[model samples]
Target: MKFPEVVSVEQADQYEQVIDVRSPAEFALDHYPGAINCPVLDNEERIVVGTLYKQVSVFEAKKVGAALVARNIAKHLDEQFSKNPKEWTPLIYCWRGGNRSGAMTHILRQVGWRASQLDGGYKAFRRQVINELEILPGRFQWRVLSGETGSAKSRVLEGLAAAGAQVLDLEALACHKGSVLGILPDQPQPAQKMFETRIWDVLRKLDPARPVFVEAESKKVGQLRVPEHLFEQMTQHSTVFRIQASVAARVDFLIEDYHYFLADTDTLKQQLRHLVTLHGHEVIHHWCQQVDAAQWPELVGDLLVRHYDPAYLKSSNNLFTGFATAHPLPADKLDGPGIARLVDQLLNLQG
Candidate 1:
């Protein structure tokens, strides 16, 4: 039998299964992409061993921690790996390629399955993600798709992706719609570290030769900020496309898109309250009255003209210099068929 190999984060994907042996809390924060959590020391057990390490002697701590690690590894062998073939190779990692993963690797190798531990473990993986995110955004040819709310920019972006165009959808990654009213009801955004990992995951697979379509998003999406270098690259160099649709089309699209708030006027009123400082209490209160009366068209029209349009114009012009001369692509139809046509138009667009 041979000693287990030591692998690095970059080569982790070549393994049949990448096993994360960190505590659940550590795994939840972030781990290597496609990694499975089979923690050697779970949450409570880790704390117990940590306390003993501090208060008791090193020998005492190792005795307890070793017993715990042994039991967990045995449990994994029986419950998780029982059905695997002898040829199955797995990559394992802990906080810093230390005793936890080393113990698992040694045991698995003893079982005649090829198992390896990651060098520098999760810390090394995170550093890789950080370093890649720093420069990856510049590698792509970016087409900044800009539009006011309800222009169906998000929907069109989805269509573009389905139609075989490379797309970097920031709002989708952030699990938000990217506005004061953008929070998804059932979807929560990932933690910042996990978010960066996901971004890096998508970028590393994309070819730099293709143009990646993305929305004109602000620095922050919901509570998460775009990686600094990414935001900088997006704002500095890109072909900007300004999508135009009639105000009526926008209103109709918004009512359908935000149907959740329409049914829950209390939520709609609360969201409107957030806009009081910008549009003044009187205008906001008037919009609330429209909400209570189920006057969506009137309320939505007022918002687009008063709130969404002006704010988008100001921000887009300020952040993207190309916005002053953005290519205007008009789509009065925002329905399913219209989105399809828009996708065709986007693929055929020239600078």
Candidate 2:
């Protein structure tokens, strides 16, 4: 068997196909971006091998684990990678760049495929993401879009992105709308590491010379925390734009954005239960009754009036230095045309 060639995390992008040789559960948590899983031991098999290593002996574990790894790799070679041309080069990785990836890399090389293993594996990619995230945020001038819930700030940010402006849509990345009720129907928020990786991935490709447009957020979006440097630069050094709309307009927009919750009142009421401590039991019960009656407009308006608006006003004033002198942008609606017009107004502000 040819010896495995180990490549550093920095050289990861040089390959067209990056294969992860870790267990599926590990890959599901976080992996190098664009890396495909071709796990050699799978979930249950890994547990069996680890238990054997502790209970029996390293020799016994290796004997069984190697057999399993060889069987799986042979299956992948026959099924997933049989037709690769001689010029096709691939990178493989495992947790800590250990024996799992090393064995596979050796096998591939021996088969006349020039396969390389990632040095230090997924951990190295994570470290690179962390280090890059720390520096990348300060490199760009952030323009923070500040507004209460339902003010169409997110839509406006989307419009900017669609128009080819550099934007970081944190809610879209997190898969939660930044509230207790923010969870999407079927889309769960990613692991916190994956969230940071996503941010790092987007930030690395953006032009630092241009301002990055982002929606104002608290330290956490859903359960995902924003990187400290990125949050600091945005609140401390960025300019703020108040995306303004009338309370009526805001209520309408929110009803539309959160329409998914409208269809599933049981889940909506369950999420509303989290507000009992802040809003009190009576208020929470009344909101639940509104849900029972399908009073979406009223409930959304009440939420904005009693919950989101005051919280936003206090937070925005306290957090953003330029919020007092923030540019007021009156958005007619949060619809496509309105968002497009808002983007035009925002770009004009840039000039």
Candidate 3:
């Protein structure tokens, strides 16, 4: 029996196995979460066919693609379908749910398993992700936290979440801290579709009636773009908590938090270099010397004052002037009890 394409988001979500029929390279660059790569035609074959379609004719391209598709499907039937349990119902997709997924479904059914195709393939799912993100913030309440760099915004989000407040760490969702230095040591960011899907998953599970605390951020984090609709809601629907601290205290906090950067002076130097265009060569050079000498606190202060401070001042002046209230935590001195008190006050303020 020939299966139809175009399942709803709920139906797609319910499928046991989500298979990506695109090539491994295509899958690696970006794909749906939990999707397995089972190419109906490998990367080279796809490229060749595409080139043929452009250079020659659609008829010739289809002729070549058909032969390659049959060959690849046979391989998958022998190697993969034979191993899976009888109950496995795989939902498959290609770039646009064209020939690739159709070919795979044909083979899977021939082997006696129910295989289906996603409507409009991965592209359609991506559209749904965008739509969901667009509508989410309107359906939920937002409590925003704003502060200078190294003010531990992400940490505060985690703490509040632990304390039973709904929270969305947009940076964590993006696999980036939303800064130049945010790239994790070895891990790469997820694809845009996967990022949106992850965000939707989190949003879907949240209590919309409760306020979710989030940090103030721009529309883009690393390579991923936050939906403009959600961002617009973030700007209007949220109340801001300003966490203020003195330069000295903030520098100390930064040093303690980012000690790993101190281990390798070169890493700090490279990051500092990016700031040199704004700060000038001599200023960054002197700071690099301070970093080399293990004057971490001093280095942190200089970098912050030179770079983060001005930006923060401008942003703070413009945004959240109507914040519900400002709860000033001690900058120069912070401990478990003090932080607990601050958090308690913030939560109480919510009530």
Candidate 4:
């Protein structure tokens, strides 16, 4: 059977299915946003093939690799593609629009499905991501929520989203809260390319005419860096909404919001260790002791005053041009009702 014609990454949505025929590790690194991983060569198998290609002849390597690819593709056909009708159309791609994708496209086409390869494969999609990141962020009008740690900016962003305001929750997407202690339990951050793909997905969905409400964030959120162009647009073009809440109120909010820390004192202490260089061993040790003693409020209050607030103030003042004349909205508490009131105020300001 003949192989199908290649399609661009931009045309991915036109197909009913998007299959990534790369190794699992490659897919984990990045692929088309919704592409399903149906690896023709898994990590270990890929290593074996590469080793054979270098040590043995290319002919010998292809012979062994072909068997492995056939077996895996057959398994996918029986297990994953069995339900598809003859009319099922899928877009397929590998690392570089090469043999891995071509094999799958040929097989699926032989089965009477209209399967097409992604031209330039994942590489093309990556190049598109790079181009979009450079230009797409500038297309949106952004409204940024800026505040100290525990000031309920995330909650406010959620409230804005729930209130039907277009919102971009970068921390949520990154699965980290943009802090030393922000690592989510059991959830690892996505690979850098995956992170960029997620951003591109969201950016593409947004209406450029409408303003996107986003939280103020540092360039890096945990282990992943925000795309340079998006970060630039966020810092330079955003109209800042500064949330106002007292230290005590913020502490109360944190105690309620981050109650997971109370249950996992050891983890909290370990995260606190990261701050030792900035706050010094003596201060971190004291904070750890406070955690050990179960003095939640006191520990949170001290961290807010000593560590988070000063750092936030310095960075926000220096980095965000709109910080000086930011619109102030009082957040008496970080509860639903309080956030709802703030959302109303925000919408009214926009109106």
- Each candidate structure's TM-score, on Cα atoms with residue i matched to residue i, is 0.94, 0.97, 0.85, 0.97
User: What lDDT is reached at residue 301 by model 3?
Assistant: 81
Residue-level lDDT of model 3, residues 266-351, one tens digit each, is 87688778877777989978988997888877778877887887876676556545343545544443345545665676788889
Candidate 1 accuracy as TM-score: 0.94
Residue pairs clashing, model 1 = none
Clashing pairs in 4: none
Question: Stretches of candidate 4 above 4 Å error?
Answer: 1-4
Error (Å) of candidate 2 at residue 72 is 0.6
lDDT of each: 0.89, 0.90, 0.76, 0.90
Task: Give all candidate RMSDs, comma-separated.
Answer: 2.2, 2.0, 3.2, 1.9
Q: What's the best-to-worst order under lDDT? A: 2, 4, 1, 3
Higher-lDDT candidate of 1 and 4: 4
Task: Give the Cα error of residue 93 in candidate 3, in Å.
Answer: 1.1
lDDT of 2 by residue, 1-351 (tens): 332498888787788799999999999888777889999999999999999999999999999999999999999999989999866689999999999999999999888888999999988889899999889999999999988888888888888998889999999999989878889889989999999988998998999889999999989999999999999999999989988888888888888888888888889999999999999999999999999998888998999899988988998899889899998998867777887888999998887
**Better-scoring candidate (TM-score), 2 or 3:** 2
Model 2 weakest 10-residue run by lDDT: 1-10
Q: By summed lDDT, which 10 consecutive residues of candidate 1 come out lowest? A: 1-10
